[model samples]
Target: MMESYLELKKRHQKEVNEFPFGFAFSPAQFVEMMRKWGLDYEKDINKIVSIGNGGYVQKKDRDNMHEMFSRHRKEIRDFISADESGEEFVYKMFLREMRNYGYGWTGDPKDTLEALGLTWEDVQNNEKLLNGFNKASEVALRKVI
Candidate 1:
């Protein structure tokens, strides 16, 4: 059986409340967390939870995940913007790509760039468009957190 949101939350209570920091879970770590949560990842590789990979998640869970991310949009954006590596723009672009696909990272961010008739250079040159992309990546990001 699939794990419920409550169970996921209860299991990773610390990570959930202090997301994007403190423990600082990576996307890969997120998948591993789900695996440890009781999902048969090895037996059902197709149903594995991963960002930018064709992993299957139940519609109800997807909806809930979307809602949660929507609620924390500002916080997520702020956190990414706070990066000091001077690569915050690229990070934002990645999130923008995720936003293009129901706020989920179903594939490479470059795919979204292509879909929009853009090249990486185009994105690099267009600050306004990048700012316009909705900050929705927190959907897939904060899934287990």
Candidate 2:
């Protein structure tokens, strides 16, 4: 009585392909949009896509941040290495301000800090930390912000 996943997927694809208005989306995207917002596939496509405008932009921004970070990862890390807490500051800033800028935080504070390859006392009295961080931020977020 119930369709298999493949059958349902095929049907959804067919529906998405046949829909004639607004924008076009793949079946998987359509299904994800529907599932994320709790809507029916037949009736809610346009509504969800319309409401998804902000989500789409957010996704694009997040993706761009990731790409930029990846491209400049070594430079960012090198700059943040100026201070023991440099990486931590960036991590927390991303969490609070950027929300999903994708700065590669490990979720564990100790591990994240340790990844910086600095000891606790290594940063004591270090004065170039802020300058390094500023340069790093400029490099890392040049395209993002």
Q: Can you give the TM-score per candidate against the true fold?
A: 0.25, 0.21
Q: For candidate 2, lDDT tens digit of each residue in 1-145?
A: 4333234335645744543323226777756655654567787544532424333322223454445445444544443453355445343332232223333332222332344444434434453544333444454455455
C-alpha positional error of residue 46 in candidate 2 after TM-score superposition, expressed in Å: 3.3
Q: Number of clashes in every candidate structure?
A: 0, 0
Instruction: Candidate 2: list runs displaced more than 4 Å.
Output: 1-25, 50-130, 133-145
* Model 1, span 21-100: residue lDDT tens: 11115667645644654555356554433334434343335565556656544443443345444234434545545555
Worst 10 contiguous positions by lDDT, candidate 1: 15-24
The candidate scoring highest on TM-score is 1
- Candidate 2 CA-lDDT value: 0.42
TM-score of 2: 0.21
Q: Which pairs of residues have clashing backbones in candidate 1?
A: none
